[model samples]
Target: MANENGEGEDIPVAANVLGTIGTILWCIQLVPQIWYNWRRKKTEGLPASMMLLWATCAVPLGIYLVLQNVNIPLQIQPQIFGALSYVTWGQILYYDHGYSRLKAIVVVLAASAISGGLEALFILTLRIPYRKGTTWPALFFGIIAAIMLTLGLIPPYFEIRKRHGRVIGINWFFLAIDTFGALFSLFSLAAQKSFDILGGVNYILVALLEFGIYGCHTVWRIRNRKLLREAKKSGRSVDELLEERELERQRQRELESSNGERFTGIDYDEEKSRPSTEAHSVDGGFVQEPAGWHRT
Candidate 1:
């Protein structure tokens, strides 16, 4: 348990430094995502689910770091910086993509809560159990983190290799950030000779997901782009094609309007032509009693 400084199991200055490096890597991860959103002015390809889960993990970790008497520097290194990254992502989604305020807020809040819960649970169990000479919390957290990390990438996997070249909910920029962030974390881990359960595995697995799946999507996107260019070069009428798309949309709207109107069951002509049946019936099938006398 002795750290290099002979500090008995105390977090080392070196670990703090590497934690700073990890924070920097996290900030860097936001860049690609932000840039993509800015360029596209949209969060179209971004996966809300992944961001939601990851942000959830970060917020709790942030809270845990704060509670641990870990210096602000260390806490800020990941917790503050990491939370900011999620916020930045959300902002891009809102301002760039014009997502409604409610939707953006939901994503932000969910991410914060999940991150805070996980971080708190991990640290509290670590500290409290260690004081009582128990490591079960650590084991449980490890298993949970592993499961989450593995499942987190499945959506992206389907997005990439589904035989139709669909990226599904995965964003290419987000994937790139995740991959490089993992690479950076691996490097940071190697440098500081420290391995934390969540950080290291998340880094590696995310990298693999990006390279294996998202990378394929990028290739397909490029291929499609090339085909589009060739079509343009051959004067295959790309604008006209897009125009036809707009026209089709209009037609669909028209059809929907017509269908809706037909189903509404309001007929002015019938209303105008219909007699007052109640009044006609009350007029008495020709005053039957008097009519009987007249007939007789």
Candidate 2:
């Protein structure tokens, strides 16, 4: 049966089913990351570049899907994906990079507008009949989009590697959904007898990278748990360990805050001449005498 667009290809029912599933997955894929960022009020290890590139690639990918006259579910997948990606990117800019709200909004909107304009131009140019029953221009854009999608994963891959595979600020649930969505999209393409080599490779790479990160997170968690157990055996409360970690982080933040200042105008010599406080060692290794108390 011909599609509404009069494209001669007969899309399979199974393809529509798989495509719908993939579309749903992709639609909600970034929600976890967005929610995580909101709850934590931080985007520490999330790669803004990854989100930006993926959002940009979606414009061409959406155009290609429309040109190919794929099912409506597949056609709209890239748009939703792109919208969520832009949101995620904005979060990174705002939280991690300290971008002002107005600045982040302007940047995201500008990028989105540029992408939409380019896609429109490409679609119009590609629809021109260059040969008998073949739209080489659409195919060209599709290939480029696929390559861009694959390349977008590079930033996150290095981020994970830099953390020695620890998940860090990444939302693992987002990765799982994204990987599954890519796999289902591949199946959809295969069902339609339109399996693209680049598309397949892109999905494979996404799944592999996500799984690698998952494995690394699992290992790190296991190791941390073992150390915690050891600490517990040494009569240390887990609460104490957590408190110590928090204190260390506080110290780091304080050090960063005090990096460029000299202690002002305090005359230590005159203060010492007036009175001296006795110092003593205590359980936590510090003690100080009360003000105006002299050692006798």
lDDT of 1 by residue, 26-53 (tens): 5556565666665666654455555545
Q: Please give the distance, in angstroms, between residue 152's alpha carbon in candidate 2 and its true position after superposition.
A: 1.9
Model 1 deviation from the true structure expressed as Cα RMSD, one decimal place: 12.2
**CA shift of 20, model 2, Å:** 1.6
Please list the residue runs of candidate 1 whose C-alpha ends up more than 4 Å from where it truly belongs after superposition: 1-19, 38-41, 59-74, 81-99, 110-126, 161-163, 166-174, 191-200, 221-228, 231-296
Query: lDDT tens digits, residues 1-296, model 2?
Result: 01112257677889778767776887789999999998998887788888888898888787777777766766777788888899899989998998999999999899888877887786676665633456776667677777777777778767767755556678878888888888887787778766656666767777776777778778866867965786779789654776787899999989876763333224555676665667777787978886566557
Give candidate 1's whole-model lDDT.
0.56
TM-score of each: 0.55, 0.71
**Number of the top-ranking candidate, with TM-score as the measure:** 2
State the lDDT at 90 in candidate 2. 92
Candidate 1 clashes between residue pairs 3 or more apart in a chain or in different chains:
56-114, 56-115, 57-115, 59-115, 59-116, 60-115, 60-116, 60-119, 61-119
